[model samples]
Target: MADLPDNASQRRARAFLPALEDREFLRRDELRGLRFAMEYHKADLLLREWGVRSTIVVFGSARIPAPEAVEEMLAAASPGAARAKAERRARLAVWYERARAFARLASVRGGALTQRPDRIRDNVIATGGGPGIMEAANRGAADVGAPSIGFNIGLPHEQEPNPWSTPSLTFSFHYFAMRKMHLAMRANALVVFPGGFGTLDELFEILTLQQTGKAPTMPVVLFGRDYWQRVVRFEALVEEGMIDEGDLSLFDLVDTPEEGWESIRRRGLHAHTPLAEAPDATPRAVDAES
Candidate 1:
């Protein structure tokens, strides 16, 4: 074969040379571990830079519409089977309002809008970054002109981040585990509303961490006692010996937003202080699994 041309040698070098900056190379399956680490560190650094000491996580159904949307949905439904579904949705729509009110309470009380540069933001509202209760919670924080976090995840159906979340603080994740990690990492408390499988999964993840002593103890408020009682028989778990009776004490049941806020306040790691004072609080460790 004839000797390769000078240009051919340059082309071969370009093809074989490692390009660390190449997006396609970084996205390969072989680099998955690096991706995980990047996800963890990116969120960790952003939160720290924003001075988010701890979060108040809100978990609930994305299906629940806003209070105003409930009436619109009801009106749009046909008078037969669809009407029943619409009515049920309307009933649950109250939770959206409750979630919003609870978030506002937490943000205002937890010093989200405080001007004290010396204090880190505590109990900043955090959500799954979708519609429904997440939107309500973010909106509540925005109502008070406070910054909030939204940890959005990629899904087949394409869930969008709520507009009310602090635009700079919002994040998107491809890994469910990473998303969940960020959710619980700095959480000072959790307020759970009536939700479906996704909500239950997230609720139990935190419960398991608390039970195992892998995570710090924080208040977990289950909104709507009637709905939770109907859904989960915590007493049954005790009777069956699957969980200790003390496990029931891990979470409190509440009916209203005010009650939920009070429950969390009573159990929060830090005492309530005036917005003017610099809050003395420590960052909760992110190493739950450790």
Candidate 2:
């Protein structure tokens, strides 16, 4: 055969070269470790670029309905046991509303929307990017036109990002460890509404972090005194000597958004002097030594 054209030869040579731009190469099994590291770096860079100084992380059940939707949901359910379950869920609707209000309060007071170029964005509401209290908190931040974050994880059921999260700040992660790391890393405070397995897991993770001095102690507000008291019986843990009595001070039980905010303020926000010209917006590392 006649010699291949020079251009064709060059094209073949280029094709054989391992191009970093090749998606197939990036997806190869050998690149899995690199891919994992990239996931962490990508999120870290984006968060820093967005000036996310710190976040108020919110966790709760995805099943909770908006306050207005509770009545409709309860009415739609069949009578008897089904109706009773709905009624119980409906009673918890207040927590959804409270989460919303708490987020708004934090966003407004935490300098989320401040225009000062010197200010670091602080106390931006962060959530799991699913419905229920997550949507409520994101919606609350959106109510005041503040930026918020959603760290969504891919699952079998495929949780969708809530509509209210700032589109640029919403992130999806394939690794639960990475997702939880991002959630806990910059949290200035944690407000947990009544929830199931996921919420309990997250709550305990932060508590363990604080208990073991793995992370800086931040205000952990367990919203809904009655619900938490009945569900966890934390005092029992103390009495049973499963946890030290001092561990009880790691969290506060608050019934209302105002109380939650106050607890956070007193525990986490009190030391810093309030800024008159614009709050001290510098981004301090959550784990920075005191």
Compare the candidates by lDDT and give the number of the best one: 1
lDDT of each: 0.85, 0.84
Q: Give the Å error, residue 80, model 2.
A: 3.3
- Candidate 2, 35-79: lDDT as tens digits: 888879888898898888788899999999998898789779998
| Clashing pairs for predicted structure model 1, backbone only | none
Best by TM-score: 1
Question: Each model's TM-score?
Answer: 0.88, 0.86
Task: Give one digit per residue, the lDDT tens place, for model 1 in 205-234.
Answer: 999999999999999999989999999999
For model 2, the stretches where C-alpha displacement exceeds 4 angstroms are 1-25, 270-290
What global local distance difference test value does model 2 have? 0.84
